[model samples]
Target chain A: MNQTIETMLNHRSVRKFKEENLSPEQIQMIVEAAQMASTSSFIQAYSIIGVTDPEKKKKLAKLAGGQDYVSESGHFFVFCADLYRHSLIGKWENADVDDSIMSMEKFMVSVIDASLAAQNAAVAAESMGLGICYIGGLRNNLPEVSELLETPEHVIPLFGLTVGVPDQKTAVKPRMPFQSIYHENSYRHQKDTVKQEMNEYNEAISAYYHERTAGKRSDKWTEQMAKMLQRKSRMYMKEFVEGKNFAKK
Target chain B: MNQTIETMLNHRSVRKFKEENLSPEQIQMIVEAAQMASTSSFIQAYSIIGVTDPEKKKKLAKLAGGQDYVSESGHFFVFCADLYRHSLIGKWENADVDDSIMSMEKFMVSVIDASLAAQNAAVAAESMGLGICYIGGLRNNLPEVSELLETPEHVIPLFGLTVGVPDQKTAVKPRMPFQSIYHENSYRHQKDTVKQEMNEYNEAISAYYHERTAGKRSDKWTEQMAKMLQRKSRMYMKEFVEGKNFAKK
Candidate 1:
């Protein structure tokens, strides 16, 4: 128990990787751990596409805003929110899949299922002295990723995971103060929590970034938020997902 | 390492409790583990509301389809996909939060972040001999869960989690043959994977259900899928979330 909690606490994203790949047994074990994660309604609404082919990895890296780790990692996988198989099962049972599968709630459930499983996979990898980084950049060119991966409708690529031997270490990024996130029996207004700690957190974040980047970047949390929240990214995700039959046809 | 792996593999959702509440220290440790989880772009886009109030728990159990377990656990929490803090930070920085925070991609990021943190918390709890069940039924009536919890705009409840000592054990549910979910190199069509194992899986599920229910229910996986996929549930989620200011004003 102590070891597992320690592993979860000591986690850091590894973007650089050694050339070595994971053994088949390691991949198998990590995947089984992922499978054991609870799915909503036992729907098991997710799929994983492991990409070891160099050509395909290169294609994904380029499509994912040129993240070199996507192509250079020990193993790369695209975790998809998949309802396609359930639809097939519905057909086998002569049921109207559109009625249940097309709602926003189900779509949200699928996202939770996929995300939870991916975290388990990550923890499993970390427990074995391996490192992993999530590649949300994959969303930058979702249409192309869909085309390249041969992903069918109702299975959208949510994010990519790069699992590898760590070639570089990253600082454990500073999180906001505890009170800012942990609420009591009822939700407290921001003034009573996050606002109280905002400046302290901002300074801590600034210091962490300053040391990590050798003083090249020393922006606080709010400064980073300003820049990140100004750009409208993946604006077409709704239409893309809905078009892929995630919505009523 | 092996012990942690085994704990993850042996996971089951325990709905019944032993009438024991966790110590304050244990809950603190679990929440810290959750804070240590990786968030996209360091956004940390999630909030957890711990609900120990009997009235709130009873109200939630009713709103969440009368799952008595919601009100009968050692600890119950509603996890929210929070962009509220980011908007506040944007206001502090004088940036236009509406353009970036309102997009579907950002919404998806928040969902992934919140779900990942919740999974970590679940694992942390399980490592300490506590059993956890995810309460997705919270979405059944989002507005009420929000109202009961006093969750404000830009903060939406995604799911709930119940943690307690296990008083009952459920059968380890069988998953689809892994080839149905895991693909090599790229996505494989259902005809090439899931169909090959569908009938076998259906029979296994039927038998399992028969044994568990003493033949009171002998339905195949296909029959279950038929019933599960015919009802549209929580269709109001999109509008509810958008109303919470997660969408552009």
Candidate 2:
């Protein structure tokens, strides 16, 4: 009911943007808001790269599978799960911290830390009347992205956020029903109930697509998920993350 | 700054809480706000388990290394990186989605999805004059926790969010300087420059602790990090996640 909840509920990803850039003050405020998010055990293991140069943004757009919004956004921020600072601290204090840094626990912490911060940034941008899109397409080619970002060891480019003035309005996509995703105390694994919920959701999604595309396309949620998941994506992610000296324990 | 940004910026982990329960309306609104967060490629691969049973919460507290707040909060929600529903969809649609579900890319997507939603829930709770603390200690015994929750394969509980009324006030912890974590175009890996920034932050943190604890604790940020990382914690996380049918490429 409050403005904060309203902003969150009205969220949508904007792919089309106007040609105006965000003010430096807005950028600073957004990043500051991100910095205020909770960090696991005070290990603020994340960094943000603000891509302002037109040439760099263009290359990034190409890297993100030709998503032009990456180049034309008011600002593009690549959120990286970074532990290079912790590594330096280990060396400074003459402590043997390689095992911890390379452990899967630390990797998960860094990923969660980066994600929590990015959500705060998104909410901050939206609160300021700007639109933002999360660029998971960056993961389509992680090695190239890492090299382009010049990230050092133990620093992985997790995802990007493209923020700009919206040139096109988007409807908020429907999510899974509360009963489908929410459980009380313990997880309920009733297959019949789950199937019933999925059936209803599939119908809802079919109607949504039908209305959105003027009957040209009407795909159920499960149909879309099934089609997309039939093909493997980013299969090298495991090896790549391991090569970066993370989750190696 | 607007109300949403203010809610985000004022976030602090609330471990001590008043013995009060969240109303059904508050819980619904919080979860609805969470459902509105952006999902990667429309894969809403996440689930939330709300623990209202005192016995279950007590067991969870024990599982989280005796973090009593896990049991004392007004409401506790466990965010799980879930691909179980997608797997079910694959079966219903007769699609061979095993390879994709088992890939690291989908695993990362699930984790990111859950984290984003949890952060939104946190913001929503804070905006409503509530408090939240992320319980990462659940990772200490994930297998037992999973068994307790009765979650199926491909559903990994990432973390817990404890929401309640704050019983204690905590100061906002100082973070690393903006220059320390923000890069312009490319990631700045200047060792000397980073060292200088770390030195200044260490001084600030030392002073903060000195003032907060009345000289009882005056540890620098780097010192605390080095000491913490020197200990090998949660070494079994890699094998645990793999055993739970995730991140297995």
Candidate 3:
């Protein structure tokens, strides 16, 4: 197999880390690698806040669904979809960059750009024999995170990533069948086959959960999702984001 | 430096790729790596269409703003933000994921999930000594791409990635100063020194462009962006995306 395929197939989330700080040079290298990613129209609408302070990490951990790994991790970075720089450029050019450009498409573009860059950094760390985990809980409190980062208009935190030296190894997570997600030529909205695949995936995930959770049968992916969706987790962040002057429409 | 970071830092678009066909196992590995990315609420709102057919690649190249690389690349995959899967799920459960669930927050989550996955696959390719380029031009004809891909409703083509062995080597692209994009707290917009950095970057890019374009001046990042933005790219894509059954209102 090609090296890329090998590395990708072997991916596993590393939550525990050795207690060691990353060198400044290493940080620069990783960030530079992230900067090399493709940006929409070269606007590069994203930013990464390298959080080094422990107290801040503690608070961040609390905000992010109480994930202790976030606070204890060696390097924590919050990636953001930032158009503030472009807005400043707009001010210089005296153009209205606020309204039309702040649509769903633009928002999605910036968020995706940031995530792509973060993933590159994650893979880079892993290739260096380091560990990484994506902290999606960062979105639990958008305004709080924005305030913590002192982010200005048109910039919102999308997610956080924790990187460090590995303290433990884990199994790579299994995914649903490709046919369930991949469509040929057009989308097929059938659920029987997908449901069957989900059931199998659920069993596999449940076994993994049991191995990790000390013989407890965890909720299936679907059940967990239904609960979270019904509970409307992080729903309040929507207004906070819009209130922060992003998503102008 | 770790191999992954080196790969990312050295990333340059490969417009030219060697003529080699990827094995089905390699393709599966890339897709699996993509699926492993963290999805918001575990909804997995993304899809990928791998295009290997020469005729389809040519048509895709033509549709994607005449980018010859699309046809020339050995492997091409279209990454999409797919809400259609969830729509089907909602139908099965006799429930609606609805407008509230499809908020900007949800949209951002799906886009990031898809992008992060794609980036992982890209890095995997790079680590394996392969070359890849992200094709943002895929958005140039969203409807056509959807039609060509047989994309169903609620799925939007976020971007395309072309991958293979490198047919030619390219110099690394220069980036804006770290300070310009990276902010301390909140955002400190409009700096006196940023202008100088911008000028430097412009000079660097212009030199690169000149070399690439046979002594012609390549406009600075901002200048190039201004020109691109003036074209009102993706102006009508908003309506088209929403029309495809994605809820915007």
Candidate 4:
């Protein structure tokens, strides 16, 4: 009975999916599971969009870094960092919610809420024999994703997920050492010894990548990260936040 | 077997804990489960600290917005949005990490990683007949919490959680309508209609609060939020982030 929790603990990104569809009942179960997650201040500041349309999925696939799995998966969902719900509450209360409360802090709350709920949904789907992969590449063309989705003001696409039966098996990605992340009481800057720990993890990650890509990229974790840093992400995000009149002031 | 997933689907906050101690093995199981959550790029940008010392718990209780559960729970853990680990990795790689990577995006990543891991811990703890209460109030005094924990640069306390065997029961909190939080394929602004749906939820929440708090406060969700927002939270968080050299341009 408790084994599911352990399964949740051992989650890994599944990039391959079999050709089968998730039943509507299963989709409803996952959505309800997600809805049950904690919302900040009872302000449910997030939303999920499920995509079962094949044509739409193909378009989204192109938008999200050309990943075919997104289009091929049994289900696709986009999590939104939302404030329009709160905006409605503001109008009901006849209160003026300025940029202050709606700023980055609020956006953060929405993002955290959405992300947590998404994780829960992921856990549930995995428990039900579904393989899942998060499509962070949705950020690469944020405006387009927003446009395609018909997202309104005070909402932004945080990420996408593809869920289906597993078509391929993958090794668990190695993580940085516990000492690197687990701090005692407060943060210590000098815990720089984590670098040594990650050195080992880097080798592990490198080998895994080599086997996965057949040596198309020998880049280790550090190298990939360095390359990723050069690319601009959500370049107009701050402006978009302001333009949508979401709180960043 | 399917009911186990329903059990996870039935999660709610647990505030009161029986006066019993948790075994170290049980604690380890939960914390290890938390540690296994996915970290962005394997950076593992978070930390959790267990606090079992009673006097220390009492002090933290005062710091955590006077939440008595802080001291009453069988176990307490402080989840931190930490980057000190990555800083160490940078040192080992002898790589200069630009401060820009520590922007709002990265900060959100750290916070989300910690939050998701905490949620997993919460779920795991619940599976084993444990009760839990998330302590967002920990952010009521971020610097003080950080100071008390000896958290160094590049790390910040995100929240705290108290887990134990249940001594008191808390009702399942009401959620917004499915349509309100779940969209089709993009963000939608349905302020007027969502507000109407929220009016019913406000009533339900009001009823829930009245029962829990003995009708000491009004039951309207909007009113409660208004009252809560009247107070300041994280007033200095931006400055704090800047002081930590996180928002450095």
The 0-to-1 C-alpha lDDT of every candidate, in the order given, reads 0.86, 0.92, 0.73, 0.73
Q: What order do candidates take by DockQ, descending?
A: 2, 1, 4, 3
CA shift of B8, model 4, Å: 2.6
Off by over 4 Å in 2: none
lDDT of 3 by residue, B127-152 (tens): 66778888888877888888777776
CA-based DockQ, model 1: 0.72
Model 1 chain B lDDT-worst window of ten: B240-249
Q: Candidate 1: which stretches are off by over 4 Å? A: A213-216, A247-249, B190-193, B247-249
Q: Residue-wise lDDT of candidate 2 within A1-249, one digit each (tens)?
A: 999999999999999999999999999999999999899889999999999988888988998899999998899999999999999888888999999999989999999999999999999999999999999989989898888889999999999999999999898889989888889988887777888899999999988889999999889998899999998888999999989888889
Supply the TM-score of chain A against the true chain A for every candidate structure.
0.96, 0.98, 0.91, 0.90
Q: Which residue runs does candidate 4 get wrong by more than 4 Å? A: A199-235, B1-4, B206-218, B230-232, B247-249
lDDT of 1 at B157: 90
What is the docking quality class of candidate 1? medium
Model 2 chain B poorest 10 in a row by lDDT:
B240-249
User: Can you list the residue pairs that collide in candidate 2?
Assistant: none
**Top lDDT model:** 2
lDDT of 3 at B175: 77
